[model samples]
Target chain A: MRSSFVSFTLNGEEKELLIAPGQRLVDVLREQCGAMGTRNGCGQGGCGACTVHVDAVPMLSCLVLAELAEGCDILTIEGAARDRTLHALQEAFVAEAATQCGFCTAGMIMAAKALLDRDPAPQREAVVEALSGNVCRCTGYEPIIAAVLAAAAMLARLPAAAA
Target chain B: MTRLRGRGISAVNYPTGMNLGGDPSQALIHATTTGNFVVTLSSVDLGQGLRTIMTQIAAEVLGVPPESVIIDTADTDTGPHCMGTFASRATHRIGNAIIMAATEARNALLDVAGEELEVAAADLETDGDGRIAVKGVPGKSISVLDAALAAHFKYGRTISGRGIYLKPRSYPDFETGAMDPDSCQAHACTIAEVEVDTETGEVRVLKLTSAYEIGRALNPMMVEQQIVGGSWMGMSHALYETTEPYYPDRAHGPVDFAEYLMPGPADIPQYDAVILERPSASGPFGAKGIGEMTANSPIPAIANAIFDACGVRIDELPITPEKLLRALDAAAVAPRR
Candidate 1:
């Protein structure tokens, strides 16, 4: 078995970890680096439960090879907050009760983050389209959509990086 | 016009506990030295907000704020027995147990508070703010924290309670085939409006308006969550989901979650639910079990809606477009009245 070392900036912290051939980024982040927030609902790319931000774009980490993330900046749910303060999206999720079972919350939040980072004020349809890839079985996606739109409005009113 | 519109309604009554009714759930509650009530139970939460609702129930019974109660129902190691989380019985069954247990603990607390305030236990009423006071005596009150501390140090007593709710098995008379099936019933009525594409045989549900009577809304938000999420599941069951779509030829069955064909956010319709809290006599503070019953009415409602649109009754689960088109074709080629 061929194993190689890969380096990436994860949640602002630089990390160099050993990876095996065919090891998925999700597995490395979970099994090797102990990032448990990135859940793997399905090993295949069908479910967006393993979504992560690679260079600020949401990518299904289950399909991406761990070695492919070398030299790239990655962010998981653990990094969504700063200074022990929750991000606006996270806060909005809590306020709206957007999660049930909480299995898809990390991916759902990441996908919503990707949409909000670019389009601060997205329509309900846009929010719906943005979260189409993430599968949440318990919430019916109503509150999640509300949380995203609320987070968008919250972001629009705040200074950059204050959340 | 390729698109045809239709409407349908369905009403159903769902039971709270198991049929025949012999299941039991238990709970134990004790106050910590800090006056926070800890409810010990083996009941599972499973994202249905069981812990939250149980905490609220305990707080209500103990006459304390919800924040002052902790639900320790993680596992069986340190908790009492429970009949598992099924048949929508946790809230109704385990909740009754908590009320019993908390009532006992409340009595014990009042006894201790009575001793401290030099009044009878019946004369002390807990004022929702964690303070036990004599009736009509505002200044003669003791904080729950001080009372709890005194219970441990000076009084040498414990404020605790144990509860269990057991429904006896109902024997049906062989003559009439009658028996008490469940503890209580929850009712629902859903009206589904849909559009059917006649040419392509595609069906789209536009809205689902429903009314539910679930005894009580202990936590209305969680109840609404169940109704919305369950309706989505019902819609999926009506037109999309099936493990045996080919019927005994399992080759084309869904192999993964993506192939399982649940309705995504894009497929969600305008879901509105109206809840009626008609309190039940056997429930915990009139709260019934309403976990997944909200999914029941929508299935038949959608089927009936499809029939109204095209005048074709497709009697099948996962009423796929092929089934609808075939039914339409069969109806068309057959002799009309």
Candidate 2:
């Protein structure tokens, strides 16, 4: 097995890690970076419980090779909160009671964040399309969809500075 | 040339709690030195908010705010015995036990406060905000924190309680086959509408409207979540999911999510649900369990909808396109003579 050193900006922090050829990004994020929030539901790219943002795009970390993600800007659910306050999306999720069991919460929030960041005023169908990859066995995706839309509306109302 | 639309409805009822050897659940409650209540149980919260629901029930019984109540679940070695989380028994069984335990702890708390206030224990009342006072005088009150401290150190009393809920076993009359196995029952009614393509025999669910008589909803949001997830599972089982493609052939089956079929976002239909609250006499706070029963009605409802859309009575698990097409062919030749 070949192992090499890889560097990437994770959660806005520039860090380097020792990675092997087969080590996935989910493994490094959970084992090395200590980001337990990024849950590993399925090792395959299926469940979407290991979703993370690479260059502000939601990608299944389980499918991404750790070495190939070098030099990329990675964002995780641990970074969703800023300055001890939850992100708008996280607040909406709690307010709407969108999370149950909390296993898929981080990935679901990260996916919603990418959608809201790209399109602040997404329609209901667009929100549904955005969350197609993620799987939430609880809450039936209705509250999650409502929470994402609520977060979008909240962001729309916020001042540019706060946003 | 055009798709045919049809609607169907189904109603189902399920018993709450498995009565195997008189299924029992136990709870332990104690007052912390910081004037808080802790509920310990072995019942696991498998994402259905069992902890939150149990905490709410304990707080209600203990006469304290919900924030002051903490619930610790799924520790079997230290916690009391629970019959596990299946059979939709977590809320009903565990809740009854917590009420018993919290009531005892509340009595202990009042005893200590009564001594501090120089009032009879019967004359004391709790304000649900961690305070105990004389029945008519709110001004002369002592914080629960002080009462707990005095009880522990000065009075040498540990405020704790233990409880268990057991349904009495009833032997079935073997000749008549009459027996009451469950303490309570929950009901669900689902109406499903679907569109079927005649050419491809593909069926797509358009909308689902359901009414659930869930005894009482301890947390309405969580109940609704369970219903929605259960409905999706029902739809998946009816139309999309199948591991055994060819029956009796064990060699071929879907191994992963890619091959296995479950409903995704694109397959979800517009869902409308109405929760009917009918308090159960035996359940805690009139709330019955709604976990497994949520998926019961939608399977038959979907099958009925397919039949209503096209007059093809395909008595099978999944109304597959191939089966539907074959049924349509047989119906066309016979044409309901």
Candidate 3:
């Protein structure tokens, strides 16, 4: 397999790295970037544990090749939190106890964050639909759904705080 | 008291109460078990709310906040040997041990606090936040932290507690398969109404109503969420979900996400959760395990619901549209008077 140099913005930091032809985007993020938050539950993209945002859209990192991520801004669970402060979704997840094993938390948080970012005021059905892809074996969908709604409410009040 | 939704009857029973005695009780107060506060448990939290439930148990016993109670998972070196997380025993068995340990720790703390504050242990109370106060002496009181610190310095040791609980010796007979394998068993009833397209043979779950008998709900919101999520996974297992064969000659089944046909955003139905919090005498705070119980009911419930709607009974799982159509055809061709 031929190796290629790939350049991408990871967690808001720009970086260039060498990758093999068969190296998946998930491997690059975990191995090269040292982002262990992007878990690989199922390598075939069946589970959404390895989901990440590529150019502002949620994409399965396991399916994307390292070469394909070239020049794209990739946002992962590490990026979701700034400094030490957690994202609203991550905070809600902890408060609501939405995370159990926490294996799927990063992916679930990312998926829900993507939905909430696009539409801050999503209906319960829409929230469920948005999180339908991410599978959480624990907490069921209730805490997760509640966390998303709560996160949305928190985000909605952020402007008020700023004012 | 908060009323439980759906089937509210307490059907599942444990012969012995949750307090499997470690030592003799003193003055009718719950005997605080010693050397068992920080128990090493074997159960794995496969996303179930075992940790929270265990925390609740410890908090209730120690008279502290759930947040203040720290539970470390079973690791080989630091923690005591425990059954690795599986079979929903974490919250039941391990939780009981935590409660016992915390109770002992609380007793020891109260003993020291009683001396420092010049009050009877019974006269003192620990608040939800673990703040200790005399019954009427508002100004004179100490916190659990203070008590623990005092106990540590005075006794020349840490005030932390530890516990280890083993499964009962007289448990269900494994050879006959008659014994209940679980420390506690959960019962659930799910009503899954689906809409199946006769033309394409695609079955869509329209609405799912799930009622589970979880001994007691330490957290009602978390319980409801577990049921709803499990219901979706169950629906996927029954209808759309399939694992492909590893080898090519094995004849490919649902190998990937596309072929597996798991319920996607378009697939999930409306969910109505009914959490039955019938406190099991043996559970910590009467809470039975709901982790795997909710998953067991949806497949049968959906199949039964489909039969109720279309007058067809499909015993096999994942009752695909193709299977339904075939069943429909076979029924149509059967001789009729």
Candidate 4:
């Protein structure tokens, strides 16, 4: 087994850590970097509870190797807030009460954030498609979808600089 | 192109708490000198928002804002005894206990405030804004923070309360086999609309609509979320998920979420719910159990819908396409009028 020091930017902070060759990025973020918001549901890529953004693209952290994330900017749910203020998506989720049991909430919100970042004015169908990979067993996805749509509306109204 | 569509309905009722033995839950409530109340419980919040709802219950009873209540559901070793969070019991058992404990703590606070204001405890009432004032004269008031401090430093009385709610077990008569088993019952009626393709034997659940007699919805938003999640689980159990594809054999079973087929966001149907509030006599704020029952009605309703569409009764679990196709083939050969 080969292990090397991998340098990457996590939640806007530059970090370099030793990683096992087969160590999944999810383990590095959670076990090493102390990012507990990323949950491991099935370990396989099936359940998207470990979803994170790798250079603005939503990828299951459980499937991506830590080595592959070297030099890439990683964003987890902990980074979703700015200056202790909830992101528009986070606020919308709270207002809509989209979270239940909160196990998959961080992943669901991360997936939604990716969708909103790509297409700020996504329709209902698009929102559903984006979150198709994330499995929430506590399972109230309707309110979650509504919350994403609401967040999009909220974001669209924000000043260009704030958005 | 021409898929057969059918609708089926199922009505069900579930008990609020466990019926086996004495199901009990305890709460410890204490007023802090800072004017906030802390509720410590052992019941786990498995995302059903028990912490939030318990806080609401305590705040309502203590005559303070919901923010003034802090719920600490620590591990069992440190907290009091609870029957755990199952059988839809958290809200009913825990809510009742919190109300009891909050009331006791509130009385203690009022007692301290009454002495400070030179009035009897009966003459004092909380204004729901953290102030205890004389009933006739609103100006004669003292903050709860002040009273809490006085009670601790001057009176040397710890403003603390403890509560426990126990459901007495009923033993069945050996001769009659009759017993009242549960504290209360919650009811739901679900209607499922599904489409079936004869060739593929694929069932697509289009919509799941239901009306639940929830006793009372302490928080309607959380209730709706639970219903949505539970209904999806029921749908998965009906048409998608399977632990044993080779029923009697243990050769090839799904080991992960990919192998196990659960419904994703794409499969979510149009869910509509109508909440009917008929407060139960024993429930907390009239809230009966809705967590477990939310997943109950949808299962039978979906099964019945598959039968209605293709006239094939899937007695086994997860009315799979292979089974439905076999039944459809058998039905085609018989052509019963």
lDDT, model 2:
0.88
Q: B1-337, model 2: which lDDT tens digit per residue?
A: 5599999999998999977688999999998888888898999988888988998899888888899888888478878999889998889999999999998999999999999999998898888888888999999899989999999889999888898999877779999989889989999999999998988988899888889998899898888888887887788778877765655566666677655667777777777888999899999999898999777788899899998999888778777788889999999999975
User: Taking the tens digit of each residue's C-alpha lDDT, what string does model 4 give over B1-337?
Assistant: 4599999999998888887878889999998878889899999888888998998899889988888889998889999898999999999999999989998998998899989999999898888888889998999999988998999899999888898999988899999999888899999999999999998888899999999998999999888888888898889888888866764566667666677788888888999988999999999999998999988899899889988887888888788889888998999899768
lDDT-based ranking: 1, 4, 2, 3
- What's the true lDDT of residue B50 in model 1? 89
Q: State each model's TM-score restricted to chain B.
A: 0.95, 0.94, 0.79, 0.96
Candidate 1 displacement at residue A28 in angstroms: 2.2
DockQ of every candidate structure = 0.74, 0.64, 0.44, 0.76
Pairs of residues clashing in candidate 4: A101-B47
lDDT at A132, model 1: 93
lDDT of 4 by residue, A20-78 (tens): 99999999999999999999887888878899999999999989999999899999999
In model 2, the fraction of reference contacts reproduced equals 0.56
Candidate 4 RMSD computed on C-alpha atoms after optimal superposition onto the true structure: 1.7
Per-prediction TM-score to the true structure, in the order listed = 0.95, 0.96, 0.79, 0.96
Pairs with backbone N, CA or C atoms under 3 Å apart (clashes), candidate 1: none
Candidate 2 C-alpha lDDT tens digits along A7-27: 999989998998989899999
Q: Compute the DockQ of candidate 2.
A: 0.64
